[model samples]
Structures are given as structure tokens and as C-alpha cells.
Target: MQKSVFLGALTVAGLAAGASAAATLDDVKARGTLNCGVTTGLAGFAAPDANGEWEGFDVAVCRAVAAAVLGDPTAVEFVPTTGKTRFTALASGEIDMLARNTTWTFTRDVDLKFEFAGINYYDGQGFIVPRALGVSSAMELDGATVCIQTGTTTELNLADFFRKNNMNYEPVPIETNAEALQQYNAGACDAYTTDASGLAASRATFENPGDHVILPEIISKEPLGPLVRHGDNQWGEIVRWTLNALIAAEEYGVTSANIEELSNGTDSPEINRMLGTEGNLGEMFGLDADWAKRAIMAEGNYGGIFAKNIGENTPIGLARGLNAQWTEGGLLYAPPFR
Candidate 1:
């Protein structure tokens, strides 16, 4: 009786979820576009290019998903959202998926009712200060004015870290990274705190990038990723597997240059399965067989996206330290496609 009751409850939950998200895939197909939520002008993450085209690491994910679903990389409506507005935009169905640098946490996952598909970037909050400030460590910033983004985990983390360290700070709250950057540049705050990657990305945009120094003390573990509202399993699965396809494409040596040839056939059965040469995995997901191929060919793989946007060659100059492939001593490992 207990087992049957549990199974019955699960069925009801599944049915509810199905009803909620059954229209997402169809709506996206009918509308002929994917609405993706992104940050409000964060360089190397989701900023517009010289031609006003959205281009960056996070933007690449949106493009890939659009290609996978609509068979066109350009079929995306990039919705710029501030930290305060991103969740509401996604939950209200104003956006299909959120690719902004949002941290996944317990309150967000359970209380707010969103599903984090996977970790796109593993980051930690840190502080940045002008070299002229003469502060070498975060411990010395007692009573300092700190610029922080509102409606983010960074704010909570900042409060906890200061209280735990027996330090105090005056928070200069802002809604977007651009505002925080302006305040930090104008000396409105003695220090600016955010994800270490964000600090670096922001600093790279300044006129004198070398003047700002990121402190070595990283205070919080921020697992940043794309998320969708709860009760949207089918829509969630499309976003999840689309990300997995990018990671898997990197793992299996599939590049945009040779993807066409590999799609025809490959000696490795796993590669063939992922590229849709020898399996109908797409059928299981209610998508065509060329979905993964379209996604990969739209941009390259996960590594390609990172390198092109924020890698060492870029102004952001982030190393593939924690984001490298699992075989290369990093944590980016995708599940088996089969």
C-alpha cells in the first residue's frame, strides 16, 4: 500500500509537470524563436558586439539551443535582465531559459522552485580594489564601502563573510554589473565584490585594467548555470541535454570543422551515438536526429565557447583551471549520452 501510494503521488506530480511544460517545446517551435535571459551587459559573458549582435560565452549557449531546436543559430531573442529581474523573467514565462551568471542554491532550487540544469561555471566571490587603496587582503577591509549586486547570492555571502570574519562593511547596492562598475570606477565604494570571474571580466573592460587588483581570498562557492522554472520537465530536458551535448562534443573530439564527416560515420560507437549517426537518441527527446549536430556546428563545443569568449587570449583572460575537462584534472564531466 505504501509503495503504491508513493507511485500514485509521483504520477500526479508528473502529470502536473507535463501539463505545465508540454506547450514550451511546441510554443518555441511555433514561435520560431527562443527567448533567453542574460545579464545586463557583462563583458565576455553576454554583451553585444560592435554590430549589436549578442556574442559571448553565455550567448553561445542560447545560440546553440536555438540551433538545436529551430535549426537556426540566429533564431534567438536575447532578453537582457538584471540580477533583480532574471528569476521573475524566467518564472513568468517571459524567457525560455536563463543563461546569466546565476548561482544555484537551496532557496533558489527549492523555495523559488527552479531547476539548475548543470554547472556551466564554478566560481567563488572575491574582492577587487584599486592598487592605490594599499589594501592587500580582504581582512583589512573593515568598515570599507563595498559595491555589491542586489538580489544575488553575492549579497548574502558578503554579509555572512563579514560577520564570520568579525569585520564590517557599508554595502553600496546596485542592480546590475554595469552600475556596480560605474560606482567602483567613481570611487563610490572602497571595494567591489562579486564572482571572481566577474571581477576579472569587469576589470578587463576598464581603461586601466592593471590598476584594479583582485584579492586572493575567495569567500563562497558559486555554482553558476542556466536554470528553468519548476514543473517544466520537457523544456528543462531540452536545455539540459543541449548543454550536455556541448560538453559531450568536447569530450568526444567533435569539432565544427570535422562534424560533418563524423556525422556520416565514426569508428567509435559512442561518438556515432552522440552525433546521431547510429542511434535515435533524438527520437527519445522528441527532437530530430540532427539536433546535437546543429548545436555543435552552431558554435563549437564547450571548450571552444570558453576559449573564444573569456579564455587567456581574451581580455578577460580566465584560465581553464576549474573548468577544464575531467581527464585534464578539472571538473567538467558530462554524463554518457547513451
Candidate 2:
């Protein structure tokens, strides 16, 4: 009986130690600012403006989380990271969360020991060649010199695409989007390959956007979103559900303009619960009742962010194909807040 009691006490202490070690909320709150890892410079995704302020679709995710956690959207220190350095920055605790447009893959999730909070953008890899190259399709480019970013799935995808098509190409390895674009424009590379959305974002920054054509072929799945380090379930939940809150807000007809009114109280129980008008869901996540309300107000709803930043109305001119809400026949859906 004495041995059994000792073992039970040890088990309880172990569990308590594990729980204490997982308290990301406490750590972030004490830090007073969220360290967000973002792309070095992707125009519609995450980039610093002339005044050094970060803005774009991906940056909005960071701001939303900041609003949720620190009650201030602008209370974020945006750390620019390259494809090669992003994982190391997150793993080493240089950044609290990564809101870059990174793909969620098995190797990245398991091998890299990162938790993919959710898929905010469903994309695919593609090639962009200058229209003058006379390449109507990706397969038409034989013996092409491709400018591709290193440490990205694009590198392997480019190799596989060429091998499967029985084509030969030279790789001009570049480190960042800016470098790849420079090499492609300077005639050092015949084509550029990356996520289709990235291709569009890059093209939008060109002096003559119409001079480039993104090939019709989309190669690999790129479910891109925010990510946090593994073994921190609490931090993972904050990032994951923050993204879901944005998506859910859009689906439930919640907008930044109406969010303040709705927060007071809503007849829709789901909306009320989500906005913290009807439940203590925020308490469960170690946040105040107005956490999600602040998040939504930070950058508007998911749809609003898309349209204002990278949608068809914007210079990026990306149509919401697969990224549309599930209610509208796309894949964007979030679990109920309750």
C-alpha cells in the first residue's frame, strides 16, 4: 500500500510538471510582444513598407494573434526570415510563431518538429516564364534554366517535374523571393517556379506585370498557414484557433464593421459564443472574453483581408478559387467556437 501511494504521487507530479512546461500563454503574456516570423519580402503575403511597417495577408495573421494575446494589434515584432532560416528561427525560439506562407507537409510537420496550426491558403506549385519566351505550357520549357528558391519544396518539385516530363533544366539557386525575381528578370534564369500564389505576388511587383505568364499547370499541393513549435500545445491552440476565428467570423457574417455591434450580444448563439458574448471560451485559452473580438477587429474578417490585400480587386488579381468559404463551395471552414 505504501509503494502504490508513492507511485501515484510521482505520476501526479509528472503530469503537473508537463502542464507547467506547456504554458506558452504565460510566456507570451510576460514577453509583452509577439515575435512573428514572416517572409523577407513577398508583396501580397508579408512585406515591410517604405516606413518599415509590415502589412499584407500573412502579416495580418500575426497582427490578429497580437490583438488576441496582447490586446493590441500593433504590438508585434516582425522578424523577416528566409526560406532556409525560417524553421531554425522558430525552433530556436527566436520567434514565438511563424505566419509566413509556408506549406504544411508531412516532413515539415514531423521531421521539422513544427505544428501546422491550420491551412489558410490551399495552393499549388507552378512556373512563371516571360511571355516572350513563347512557352504556353510548363512542359514546353525544355533545357530551361529555372530560378528557384533554395530550402523550399519548389526545389524538389522542379526536379521531379523535369524528370517526369523527360526534360532537362539547369537550376539557378536563389535564397529569397527578391533574389529569384532579380535572377529571372536579369536573364540568368529562363523561368521561375514557386507556389502559384507566390508567382502571382511576384508578378504583381514587376515593372511590366503583363510581360510574364504563369503556366497553366499546377504541380503540387501547398496548404499554407501559420505554424508554431512542437510540444507547446497551448501556443499551438492560440495560433490555430486564432486562424479559425478569422475564417469562422467570415462564414458567420461577422465583419470588422459589425463586430463591435455583435460583441455586445447576438441572437445567433454561435456568433455570440465566438465573439465572447455568451460564453467563457476565451478563459479556457487563458485569454479575456474579448480576445477574438479584438482579433477580428485587427484586420477584419478573413474575406476582408483577402480582398483588400490579394484578391481580384487588388493588383495581385488572385481570384478566390479554392480559398472561398466552405459554405460557398470552397475548402475554408472552421469548427464551431462552442
Candidate 3:
């Protein structure tokens, strides 16, 4: 009787969550804008420009989703969230989806009742220190003070990495990347730890970026991506496929430069289906035929977005490494659009 009662309650809870997720789609459509949660400020990932317009790799995902759903990429309100507030904002419906640099963990996915749409960036935790510290590797810093963002997986990873190595250290807790940068620059911490990509992003903003060197040790696997509340399977699918559309676009040679022409007519059946020329896939998500087309046009495909924001040429200077296309020896492989 206890098990049966618990199962019943679980089902009811799931249905309630699903109802909320379903309503989010309608609410966004009715309001004609997407409320997307983003980092307070992490250059090359998500941050405001001099014009006060949000633009970056992560911001592109939010714009693509807005374009896919509303056919207007600009129809979005970017909500700045710190590591501590991001999940709460998403859970409270303050944001329709979260496009922050959040890792997909088991607890956040199941226990926290959230669903990661898909992995956009394959990252790992690393450390950055001033060159003057003479620390060439993470293992060398035994008693160093570390600046870590609170309410993030990095905190636990920081503790675990040190404990496993039998090292002792002092932690300087911070809430945002800006704070970590300020504290680290002010000598409040000996080292700053976060996703390797983030370290690069933060370092790029330094007065003399070459003054700091990121350690060689990659401490944790952080598959970062967008996420939505669980039990909202349909909304989840919309976000998932929208991201997939961008990945598939890159793999199939559908770029922002050629997407419109290809959408009109393409030789590849997969491209045709994805661009909504040969199938009713959009109907599956309650969107129009040109949904994926609009998404790609919003900020180009995944590779394009990456190159424009954090690629080797950019100040953040990230390479395609693991984020490259599956056909090119990376981990990015999108399911067939058909």
C-alpha cells in the first residue's frame, strides 16, 4: 500500500509539472517573447555588449530558440542570473529556459526536476593562476588559495580534486565570474577555478592576459548546455530539436549564408526535411515549416556561432577540439532530421 500510494503521488506530481511546461509554450507564444536566463557576465559565453545587447555563444542558443518559436530572434528578454539564482529562475517560470553555461548533472536532471536539452559545449574544469605564482600545474598548488564560484559543481569538484590529491587549500567563495575576477585580481585568491572555457573567457578580459596561465590539468567533465524543467517533454523536445537543427545544419553544409537557398530546395532529403521543405516536422512541435530555417538564420549553425564568439580568432580563443562535427573527429553528432 505504501509503494502504491507513493507511485500515485509521483504520477500526480509529474502531471502537474508537465502541465506547467506545456503552459510555458503557450505563455511564451501569447506574450511574443522568450525569457531566457543567462550568466551575469561571461564573455564569449553570455554577456552584454557596449550596445547593451546580449550576444555570445550561449546567447546565440537563446536567440535561435526565440527565432524558432517566434520567428523573431530579437523577441527575447535576457535575464541575467548568477550560478545561485539560475535554477531558481527557471523553476519559478521567471525564465522560459536557461541558456547559461550549466553542466548536465544527474542531480540537476532528475533530483532537481530539470531536463538538459542537449550538450552544446564539451568542457572540463581547470585552474588559472598568475604567471608570477610560478605554478605550472594544478598539482603544484598544494596550499594555494582558490577563488571558486558558490552554488556550482566546481565547488564540489574543487574539494574532491584536492582531497583526492591529498592537498590542502583555502577557498575564497564568490558568486559571479565578475566577483571571482575582481577577487582574483585583488589577490584575495591564489587561483581561480571553473570550466576551462570560462577561465579562457575570464583571462581574455585581463589587462594583460598573458600574465596568467591556465594549468594543464582538466579536473572534470562538464557538458554544458541549455535546460528546461522536467515533465515538460514537449517543450523539452522543441528546445532539443532546435539545437539539433543547428548541429545538423553544420554537418549537412546548411549555413546561414546558404540556408535560405537550401530551404527553397535541396538535393539531400535530410536537409529538405530539416529545413521544412519535405516534411511536417514543424507540426510535431507546433511551429511553422520555417522554424529550423529561422533558427539557423538567427545566428548561423553551431560552428558558425562558435567561430564568431569563442573560436581561435576571437579574444577568448577556443578551438573546435571536442566541439567539432562528428564527421570531423569530434563528439558532435546530431540525429537525422528525418
Candidate 4:
């Protein structure tokens, strides 16, 4: 089943054709829901909880977009997509946006005709093996059977890393993270290769997580973020600035606890503009003034979202590291709201 009458033209024809076609933002509004593409199931990223509600850092992006556009966070339909299917889902209009942990690469950005709004997480490729393998370093896995996910940057990076290291290895290609975990745990592969953050998330779900160790080698950079289709500037801006608002909210000390109070008034001009107290920024985007406020109130801020999902205290146990705010010496800098 495909929802791609207009998007098919958008994909095959040029950007001008897409622009002349039905606007995705308008389509989403008329449909009464935002279709958001997410991973099949990556813990602390995009997964169903016990009650079947999707929740995670990536899921929050979708909810925020829905809240910003539709004025209701729960108005999003979470579409689970694999690495191979995510792009098609976005291009075919099966999904309005993709908030999975996808990397920003040249080919995907250019050749695939997609646009990454901005990087939400900075990551690196890594290897994980059983502790008993005694493989403390990635270089030790010369003859390892690596479980790599197909249709992801990991495949090429794994090959490149092995070729550059002059090491011989066998590939065990899998589809989703769950399949990778199954194969790696079943001894079908000697090690699993993916983003370091993924390794942590996967290991955290194992029955005995302490039995595995992630190698220290970070083979390649993985700047992961939400993406929208190319040529849909309106839809793109909605997702892009919504993300920036969450980041900016954190930097400006705007949390869910005090958003309502701060909405009444604020001393900082930037905060006032960001929270929609004194600007027509949302109107400039053809949305209500409370667009960003709804988005921020839906999820708190970027740091709060991380801490509640995959941060140091969560099962993923990830530190702020490079994902901390720019003021804190990290790369997470949002543009001025004004």
C-alpha cells in the first residue's frame, strides 16, 4: 500500500514539479495526521512501549512536528521503516518526515534527493563483541564474522575499515537492529558493527549485557538526524526549525516546567521570540504563534529528551559527550530565534 499519488511525481519529476504539486504540509493538514517514518525498533530511539505507544528520542521529533503543525502531539502516525525502506517511505509520501537515527551522507543527501534538516546526534561507527572473545580493539577482529545491517552506512564503512586495516572478515548482513542482535547473539556473527550509540542501545537490551564490550575504535563519523523530502521547502522548514526550537529551548533555559509561566512574559528577547510572546516567526511559517511553544511543551528540550530516553541514566547510558550544548563545548548550537 502506497500513499504516493503526488509524491511519485515529486520523486520522478524535478523540484519545480514537486513545488507545483500538492504541498506536503497542506496534505498532512488535510489528512489530519502527520505520517512520521521511524526505525523498526531501536530501544531508546524509536520503539513501542509495553502499552504499544511509541516513545524515544527520535519519536519525540515526530511528536514535536505534529504538535507544531497540528497543535496535537499525538496526531502523528508512527510508520516503522527499515534502512532500505525509510527513504522510499519519505519520497512516496507514505511518510511526511523521517526521524529515525539516519546519518547525513553525501550520496543520500544528493543522489537520493532528500534533505537532512540538521544533525541531532553526532555518532561514530564501532564494533561490539562478546567479552570472552578478548577483542578489546577492532583491529583484533581480523577474521571476525561481522554482523552488519544492510542498506546502512555501516556496510561500506565496515568494508573500508577492514580493507584499510588489511584484515580479512566475513560479512553477515541483516536487515534491522533486532535481526542484528538476534544473529550476533546466536553466534552467527563474531561481532556486530554499527554506530557506537546503536551498539550501546543493543547491548543494553541483551539478557546479559555485561558479557559484551564495544570496541574503542570509532571508524567513521555518523551525524544522525531527521530528514524531509527534497523540494518541499515548507514541510522542510517546519521540521528543521521545530528541531532548532527544541535545541534553542534548552539553551535558553526553557523547560516544560516553566513554559507556561515564561509564556506570560520573559526578560530575554530571544526567549520571548522563541516562545512566541513577541514575534510573528510562526506566522512567517504559516503556522500559529504557539507552534514552537507546543513543540517545546510536547517534549521539554533536547537535553531533557536525551536524558529521559538514551542519556547516561537511561538503559543506553550515553553521556552528553559531543551532543551537549554549544555553550558547554559541544556541537549542538541552534540558530538565533530572532
Candidate 5:
């Protein structure tokens, strides 16, 4: 009958959907590269150097995942996306995962049909203005023109902050961090508003970084992280635990220099299990025994990546405030690897 045929077709379509959702890992392996979505440019987070080589804290996550899956850190195609384009790119499967400085939010996670793997950076919204503007705080920018990225929580936060303060401002919508910097420097906007960490990153790129000062007001909580499409739990688990491995590595004092020795078997039972000495934890995720080891070895540990890329010694000069390890009085905590 026609009804029976329609039911069978629906069943086949459901199976196909399930199969596509499960195909990300296998596709990356077959293609030999992980397509990682990143910001167009955000210094110390994700950006290209003068030589056009991409390197930053966010880039390290992609490299670590690639190393874990393919045993090659360089096996990645970095897809640069703007605020408006990032979600579309991920939803359409243009990229395997997004490691950009994207905030995790309710609408994005539920309505937008995406899964935020984990928070890699804890941040808050803040304002940055040229010191010449004589604006010491966000409250002073009552009627200022603000350069903010569209398609971001920044826009909503900016609106809320101004309304709460009973102030008003004009929004100069920008699509990328580089554009926001350009517009702010050109005096197109009176202030550049974004996550406080981003304000530091943006200011570091200026010719005279000292000319701009980030206002001290930390307005909104921004827990930025990697995300994947909603329907794929397997893919989500792979990316999520890959990040957790990095964090856990730092917690256990497992550096890249000693990962090989630790893989041989550590005296600590937790380290042994994490390094795949006792169980087929990697195999459970359809990876090799040395997956986490390779990921940690690709970069160092979480702290190592942070220090090398965007620490206070670097041009970005970001201190480990809220981003420090949980034990160090910050919120960066990893769940038990065991």
C-alpha cells in the first residue's frame, strides 16, 4: 500500500540522518585533515602572523585535535569565519568544529541547534577607548558610538549595559575583530566593546598599544569555547574530551617533554589511565592508545599553550585572572579523566 511505502521511506531517511551525524570522525580520517573554524583575526586567540601563518591559543586546540585523531598537528584546514558566518558554517558542515572565541549561550546551544563542547576561556564584556578620549569607565561613555561585532552576545550585552545605566549610544556594527580595530582606530567609533580578554587582544595589535585603555568594568560573563552541530553526540564527545585531556594534562603536570615516558606507565594510577596504560580509553572513542599523548605532545599542556601564545610576556599580555587553573583561584577546572 502507499502508506506502507511512505513509512519505509521515512525510516530510511531517519537512518541516513543518523549516519551523517556519525560521519564526522570517519570523514576527517578519510580526508586526512580536520577543518577547524576560527575567527577571521583576533590576536593571541586566533590570527595570522605577518608571514600568514595562523597561531594562537585557539589554533592550538584545533592542532591538538588533529594530532589526537591523525597523529599530525599540521593536518588542519583553518576556515576563518566572522561572527555572522560562524554558525552557518558549522551548521552547514563547512567545518568540522569551531575553535573561535565564541561565547556559549542558551539560544545558540538550543534554538540554533549546536553543542558547546566546553568552555576554554572565562571572560567578561568590557569597553576599550583611546586614552585621549578621557573616558575612565564604561559609565562615562553615555552617548558614545560603540564598535561591536554583530551576530554576537556582545551586541545584546552592549544594549543591556547601556539600558541598565540609563545611557544611550550608537552601534557601529562590525563583522570581524580586525574590522572593529580598524574602525575604532580610524575614529569611526568612540569605543570598542567586546569581551575583556578581546579588548586586551585588540589593544595589543595597535601601533601604540598604550594609547588605548580597557575600562575596568567587567559587565557580562562570557564563557567562550568550541562547538559542533547538535545532532552528533559522538563528534561532540571527541572534541569535548580532547579539550578536557589538555586541561587534565596541565592538572597532572604531564608536559609534552615527559608524555612519552609517562605513556610507558606512570606510578600514579590516574596518570596511567589517562595515558592509556591500563585501559582502551582511546579505543572507546575509536582512536589509538596514544591519542591523548599525541595531543599533549603536539602542544604542551593547557598552561604551556596559554603562556606561549598569549601570556603577559606576549604582545597580548593577558594575565591568568579568571582563566587560571581552578586550584590557582580561577575557574579553569577539568573533569576527572578517569
Candidate 6:
């Protein structure tokens, strides 16, 4: 009958929608590359090296994900996205995930139809001014020209901070961190405002890094992370657990140097499950048993990545304050592998 055919058609449509919802993983496997969105260029976060090889903290996440899914850490297309273009790139499927210094906010999470995989960096908005400017505090910047990245949480936070202090300032909006650096260096803006970690990265690139000082006040909490499109729960879980694997690896003392040895077997059940020596954890996410192992091996553990790229010895010189493991009195704690 016509009614029976209509019911069957509805069932078929539902099945098709479900399939499409989980399509990213299969698409990525077929393509053999993970398109990862990152910042245009931020020192110690994401940027090309002397030989034009992409290398940095955020870049490592992209490489790790590619290794987990594609079995090759180098199988990644790093799409450079500014503050405005990053979201659109991810939404349009131009990129599989965004690993830029994007903050996890209420509207961005709920209204933007994106799922934040996890917080990679706990950050806060702050300001930097040249030491010659004699501005020791953010409150002293009333009526100053502030260079801020457009389409970011810093825009609103800058407004709120000034408003709270009964201050007013001229906004000098820039699209990228590089532009902000240019404008601020050229005296187009009196101060540059962004995440504190970003300020450190920027200052490290300055000709006279000692000539500038980041203000003491941190205005807004920026829980920066990687994000994927919302509908693909399977893909989201893969990315989420990939990052968790790195964190847990660091917590359990599994470094790149030791990961292979540990993978042979370990005393800890959690380590065994994570490294695929025990349990079907990777199969649960439709991947091979060695997915997490590949991810960990690709970039070393999260702690290793941090220490190499942005730690005190690096140009960025960011101390592991809030980003340290929970057992080390920091905010990082991953779920059990089992």
C-alpha cells in the first residue's frame, strides 16, 4: 500500500541521517589525511620552522590525531585560520578539527553547533605594553589604544574590563596575532591584549623581549581547546580520547622513549588498556588497537610536548603552572582507560 511505502521511506531517511552523522571518521580514513585548523602563526603554538615544516604545541595535537587515525603523524593538512575563519572552516568541513588557541565559551559551545573535545590550555586574557609606556597595570590603560583580535572572547572581555574600571579606550582590531604584533610594534596600538600564554609567545618574538611587560591582571578565563563538529559523536569521541590518552600517558610516566617498552605490557591495568595491551578500547571507537599508542608516540606525552615547545627552557618560557597534571597540583586529569 502507499502508507507502507511511506513508512519504509521514512525509516530509510532516518538510517541515512544516522550514517551521515558518523561520516567524518570514514571520510578521514578514505582520504588518509586529517585536515586540522590552526592559527595563522603563533610562536611556540603553531608556525612553520626554518625548513617550512609546521612545528609547535598546537601543531603536535594535529600530528597526534593524524597518527591515531591515519597511522602516520605527518598525514595532516594544516589549514591556517584566523580568529574569524577558524569556526567557518570547521563548520564547512574544510577542516576535520580546530586546534588553534580557541577558548571554550558558553555561546561557542551551545550556540555554534560545535563540540569542544577538551581543554588543552587553561588560559586568561591579559594585556602587554612596552616598558617605556610606563604602564604597570591594566587599570592604567584608560583611553589607550588597545590592539585586540577580532571575533574572539578577548574583544568582549576587553570591553568588560575597561567598563568595570570606569575606563574607556579606543579599540584597534586585528585579524591575526601577527598583525597585532606588527601594529603594536609600529605604535598603532598602545597595548596588545590576548591570552597570557599568547602574550608570552608574542613577547618572545620581540626584538627586545625585555622591553615589554605583561600586566599583572588576568581579566578572563580562557579554557582553550580543540573542537569538532557536533553531529559526529564517534569522531568527537576519537579526538577527545586521543587527547586524553596523551594526558594519561604523561600521568602514568609513558613517554615517547618508554611508550614502546610499556606497550609490550605494563603492571597497571589502565596503562595496558590505553596502550592496547589489554581491553578493546580502540575498537570501541571503530579504530585499531594501536590508535592511542600511535597518538602518544607521535608527539610524546602532553607533558613532553609542553616542555619541549613552551616550557621555561624554550623561547616562550611558560612554566607549567595550571597545566600540570592533577597529581602534580595542576588542572590536568584524564579519565581511566577502562
For TM-score, candidate 1 versus 2, the one ahead is: 1
lDDT per residue as tens, model 1, 145-194: 99999999999999999999999999999999999999999999999999
> Against the true structure, what is every candidate's RMSD?
2.1, 3.3, 1.2, 5.1, 2.6, 3.1
Q: In angstroms, give how far residue 101 of model 6 lies from its true place.
A: 0.3
The TM-score of predicted model 6 comes to 0.95
Candidate 6's residue-wise lDDT over 1-338, tens digit each?
99999999999987786677679999999998999999999999999999988999999999999999999999999999999999999998999999999999889888997999998899999999999999999989989999999999999999999998999999999999999999999999999999999999999999999999999999999999999987788999999999999999999999999988999998999999999999899999899999999999998999999999999999999999999999999999898888
Cα lDDT of model 4 by residue, 182-221, tens digit: 9999999999999999999999999999999999999999
Model 6, stretches more than 4 Å misplaced?
Answer: 1-18
TM-score of each: 0.96, 0.94, 0.98, 0.95, 0.95, 0.95
lDDT of 6 at 41: 96
Q: Please identify model 3 stretches exceeding 4 Å from their true place.
A: 1-9
C-alpha-based local distance difference test score of model 3: 0.94
- Tell me the deviation in Å of residue 169 in model 4: 0.8
Higher-lDDT candidate of 1 and 3: 3
Candidate 4 local Cα displacement, residue 302, angstroms = 0.5
Clashes of each: 0, 0, 0, 0, 0, 0
Error of 4 at 202 (Å): 0.7
Model 5 spans > 4 angstroms off: 1-16
- For each candidate in the order shown, give its overall lDDT on alpha carbons: 0.93, 0.92, 0.94, 0.92, 0.91, 0.94
lDDT of 3 by residue, 217-326 (tens): 99999999999987777788889999999999999988999886897897899999999999899998788899999999999999999999999999999999999999
